[model samples]
Target: MSDLAHLPATQALKLFRTRALSPVELMTAVIERAEAVEPRVNALSETMFEQALEQARKAEHAYVHGEPRPLEGLPVATKDEQPIAGRRASDGSLAYAGHVADTTHPVVERVIAAGGIVHARTTTPEFCCAAYTHSRLWGITRNPWNLDYSPGGSSGGAGAALASGTATLATGSDIGGSIRLPAAATGTVGYKPPYGRVPAMSPYNLDHYCHDGPMARTVADCALLQNVIVGPHPADVVSIRPAVHVPERLGDVAGLRIAYSPDLGNWEIEPDVAANTRAVADALATAGAVVEQVEVPLRRADVMRAAFIHFGAIFGPMVAGVADAHRDELTPYALAFAEDSRAALARDGFLAGLELEGRIYAVIGDLLDRYDALICPTAGAAALPAGEDYVDTKLTVNGVQLDHYLEYSLTPVFNIAGRCPVLNVPSGLSSYGVPTGVQIVGRSYDDATVFRIGAAVERVLPWPTRPQL
Candidate 1:
């Protein structure tokens, strides 16, 4: 039963097809796993076990008596950031605790249509702003590997659930490393498809920095979910047409020219993270991929300044608008984020942000032009405290204190360079047991190459599917 809970979606689907494993059996085991570990991990906002079991039974009927859909009976944990018409869409804020959405997000709609059963709603930071996952409404979502540390947000709960064996597949959104950070912290596979690969809610769908993607225990499973959720939607004007397809057999990266960026030239990364990143580079080289170390001509401060300015011009105003109406009800970090965004908007302005974005992309674009994919650490720090708020403090890395806590991650630059498809795969674990990850960045709209590289990496350096929970 325990093994069944941690089974990969692809393998489980095979079992269902062979009539070897009934959908009800998998759903029940998953529900039991959730009930057992959720008290410690606290990853779910709400569970639909009753509904999931019913769906699973229906899936079994379809398999036995009719045609089963692509996903068939798989359990998917939906990100709380997306709406599901008639369900509460709190945005992880107390102000909207009673708010209910009237429409389903395109990603969720696709998941349901593909026969994926949503068993739970995952937690996120308020308005999905912070790198850590905690809100006044949902409390703290801890890592399954180390309860003292966070799973990484704003998709923290999804990562935690995957690592804890409570979920086989989960959805995530990345504006500033939300998906990759959690995947790094929890030893999971996460994909941040090029901005328009997966359809999203309006406004954000137009914001190139935003991407809704997939998170799972393996690259194959991540691809499984990504293929189902991607494609154009009538409601989202910016969604890409003729949806990109992920090939099932991503054979190998035997002759691929892969580039490596150890520190991106400027950010101060911890010694462990640097070592793990190099280890991945070494593994890629061993697999016949030409992994060459390259220099990133960029500064952490400049990249973050542009990210904040962009956020200020777009996401910041939305959060600030909410804050203006309900100052007392918001989380302290959310309030701080709003204030910081307003200040950023005033200082750098939108046009300046656009210029900086172009400069940032020029660096990545140039690198990708020379190489098939670029590799780098997902986050500089291995883990962050689950419950502590780093809103007001400067974070330290490599014994050097930084100006801002968010500087610890190397994820925002990719958001600025929004056209590249980036996938996060585990590199190694810290001495403290927290996981570290590296990103495989591909050329614009070239999603298959990144997944191919990811599949190669997974074959060489496999990540443990479940924490020792």
Candidate 2:
């Protein structure tokens, strides 16, 4: 049962098809694993164990009858921020603490249609506003590698579950690196598909930088789940027509021209993270890909400024609408974000952000034209304290102080270039035991190239699925 909890979805499906494993047995193992780790990590916002068991029984019958569906019986941990009809979608906010979603998000609907059981819904920061996963509503989500550090946010719980063997596969949404950052910190694989590659719930679905994708232990496992979740839907107008399928066996990266940037222009990175990024570049070069260190004309401040503008213009106003009615109930960080957003929006920050985004993309587009893909460190440092406050906290990388806690992340830059696909794959583990990762940024809307590079990286540097939890 314990070993079953750690089986990858691809391998588990093989076992299920051969009648060597039953969905009931797999669900029971995952339920037990979740129980064992939830106390330590607080990854799950809610659990549907009995419902999952019922679904697993149905899946078991299907397998015996030779009528198994895609992802039949597989356990999926959904992010709490996404709606799952009739379930509580608190989104780590006190304002909506008692709110039940009336409709399920397209991603969750697709997961169910493909026969994936939602055993648990994972935690997120308040409205998923912060980079680290601690919120007043769900407490802190700790990393499996080092419990004192965060699993990484927004999708922090999803990443934590994959690392702790609490779930076979999980869902994640990236708007400014939510999915990738947590995956990088936890030694998991997270894909931030190009904008509209997967359907999303509005009004965020309309936002160009937002994406919902898959997270898993292996790149192939991630691809398997992605195939089930992606494709256009009537619910989201922005969803691209004619869904793209990512092949399970993305072959080697030979004769490919890849670019590596240590600093993406101006951001301080920790020594361990820098070394691991370089190691990955070297490994890719040895794998027959032409990996070159190139300088990208991007400044950390410009990226941060643009991200804040977008957040202020879109997410801030939405949050403020709720906070206005329940000001006393909101978290301090959420409150501050609401307040700061008003100020930024008042100063024409949103328009300025749009202009800067064009400038940033000019440089990125040129690089993509010259190279097949670009690789860079996912975050400036490894996981920070699990309970760190985003608003008041300060991060110092290589003796230099970051302007904001979120400044340590190198993900939002790609969000500024929203059309490109990005995948975060583990590079190495830090001295503290937490893993470091590199992002494979592909050409605009060219999702397969990033996965191909990620698959090659995985082959060279195989990562362990679960930590010593």
Candidate 3:
């Protein structure tokens, strides 16, 4: 059960094509594995096993008789935040517990079209606005590696499901490290395509910081799903035209100039995270790439202020709209996010934040000009405890307490510079027994370079694809 359930999507597809592995067999293994782990991980919000098995049967027949699609016979877990038209879409909140989606999101649409079977929908933070996953509706979701810790969010469940061998492939979204943080925590690979690379629903599609991408146990699988979900869609006016293609096989990072930042010029990272990141940096150097550890002079305060101002104008209000008269039903983190953003909007207008974003990017843009990509810790801390909401708390890293948890994460800056594609790959496990990762940051719209660097790192320093449960 563990072996079949943990088969990589790439391997599963080949076996399916050869008729050596039936989709039904793989799907059943995954379902049983998911059922077995749900009590501990709580990664899935809902399951459609009967429907998924039926779909897998059809997919198996397709591989035997008809032409198989790219993700044919593979089970994919989608994030619950995306609607599936009439399926209950609870954004991890009780306020909209029974609300049904009117239309399917483009990301899910593409996955289904590619013959990917969505066996389950993963969990999220309330309104998909918080940094960690937990809600007043769904019970807490824990890390598969260390049940006491978090798998990161707002794509916490996707990360968890992939780690626990419950899903071969999963969809993820990123706006300030939602995808990467969880991926880091769970020891999976997650990609945050540069803004506009993948089509999204309205409102969020227009927000540059928001990105819908892929998460998988391997880089090739992430690229496989990313290739499916990317490209322009009629529903998304902002989706980039003439889609950028990610190659299946990326070349070595040899001779490429890569810049490395330990703290991103600000917050102090945990020793575990810093050491693992340094190991990756060292691996890159050994792989024939020039790895230069450099400083990026951007204060944590300004980056947070700009992000808050933007979120306050949009995400905050959106969360509030759902919590309209039902504010009391919102989770503590969601409420805090809304209130904090409301205050930010009141304190500083959107234009001010836009100006700050430009200034923030100016520094990053200048630095990227000197290198092929920037390497840094995905999150300053390696592990976050499950069921713990730090809404009014501070965490320490490397003997220094950070101002806020967000300050420790280097993700928001990339969101502020939203065009930069960031890929988070596991560096190694932390002393806490959870995963730590480094972000391979690419220049604006150069998605290929980041993947190339990620592939190089994966080759030089191969970590365990999934933890033994």
Q: Which candidate is the best by TM-score?
A: 1
Tens-place lDDT digits, model 3, residues 1-469:
8899889999999899888899999999999999898988999999999999999999988988968999998999999998999899778888889899999999999999999999999999888887778887888899999998988999999999999999999999998899999999999999999989999998899988899999999888889999999999998998999988898878888899999999888867888899999999999999999999998998888999999999998889998787678888888788888888899989989889999999999999999999999999998888778887777787777787776667767799999988999999999999979999999999999988999999888888998976767
Predicted structure with the largest lDDT when compared to the true one? 1
Error (Å) of candidate 2 at residue 261 is: 0.5
On the 0 to 100 scale, the lDDT of residue 118 in model 1 is 98
Q: Give the whole-model CA lDDT for all candidates, comma-separated.
A: 0.92, 0.90, 0.91
Quote the RMSD, in angstroms, for model 1.
0.8
Candidate 2 has which clashing residue pairs, if any? none
As a whole number from 0 to 100, the lDDT of residue 396 in candidate 3 is: 74
Least well predicted 10-residue stretch by lDDT in candidate 3: 400-409
Q: At residue 319, what lDDT does model 2 achieve?
A: 84
Clashing pairs in 3: none
TM-score of every candidate: 0.99, 0.98, 0.98
Regions of candidate 2 where Cα sits further than 4 Å from its true position: none
